[model samples]
Target: MNNISNKIKLRREQLNFSQEYIAEHLGISQPAYVKIEKGVTKLDFERLLKISEILEIDINELLEKQYIVNNFKNSDSSTAIGMVENLHQENQKTNELLIQTLFSQISDLKEENKRLISILEKLSSNK
Candidate 1:
């Protein structure tokens, strides 16, 4: 399993939350939630954010590697926290870039669709 998946499962257990409860909150089936914990289902940013909210912890906690979070009670907690913060920031920037790219692609596709429609209209008029 991915480290993040393990951390999510551990946090859920720590909160004494059942898979069914989380599934209900996420509007997904229990089996689907199970797949998430098992790392069988890929987690998108939105779903990860929702899971973090449902778990009642900072999203960074979920973003952090399991080892780092586990060591938070130790003297290196600051370092661990910093690493998690850096990772979260990087993830946020990457997500922003992906959203921008997707929007650009969508706009291009829309223009192409409009051009195609116009061509079809001209062809019909000629016919």
Candidate 2:
């Protein structure tokens, strides 16, 4: 429960969202929202889903205890930031590879077109 609370708080803060904003979204009072973050109130699944949506995070991320423990321990934001950066880098690499493959395919198609044009010119001249 404490781990969940910590994760919610950490994610909220990371997004720079105020407690009152989250409370309004949840249709609850600020104090009630605070209790949820403090681990004094238990959150229902629906409410948890709503929170995850509002935070723009996956429900599994909010619910994973081990990940929460590892990332939130000592309130280290760098670990999470580093993970996001790494994912971004990987995505960039994948995009670059995809672009390269497309370009190569286009070049091959252009060459094939040129070869076919030359063949057609030779055939027409022979006639």
Candidate 3:
């Protein structure tokens, strides 16, 4: 499956969202939605438009380098070679998790990191 589709599927599952719900939101049939999620059918402009609205995510997030980097970083590694292996493993694990939506996880992590940065900045200013 295409990596993009894999990601879409993962995010959808993570949210415990049903395909029917997404399809309803997209105003598409469940089979059509499944085809989109499976990457069997290319995402036309109309579908992309609907997906962005329903997922409440900017189209950019679907193609962000930051997301790619974060996923790679979380895949534990002992060395460069090990890092590659870990990433492969992590990708496989993610595929297995029935992850429906990553926005929650990614958003929470971002908020936490933002809070940490603010604290660090404050501490630095104290000096």
Clashes of each: 0, 0, 10
lDDT of 3 by residue, 34-95 (tens): 98888787664446656766766676555432334565565545554675665576456544
Q: lDDT at 12 for candidate 3?
A: 77
Candidate 1 colliding pairs: none
TM-score of 2: 0.52
lDDT of 2 at 78: 85
TM-scores of the models, in the order given: 0.55, 0.52, 0.47
Candidate 2 stretches greater than 4 Å from native: 67-127
Per-residue lDDT value at 126 in model 2? 100
Over 1-127, each residue of candidate 1 has an lDDT whose tens digit, in order, gives 6656888899999999999999999999999999999988877667887999999988777765444445667658678778678667756754674586678778999999999999999999999
- lDDT score, residue 49, model 2? 77
- All models: lDDT? 0.81, 0.80, 0.68
Cα lDDT over the full model 2: 0.80
lDDT by residue for model 2 (12-56), tens: 999999999999999999999999999888665567779999999
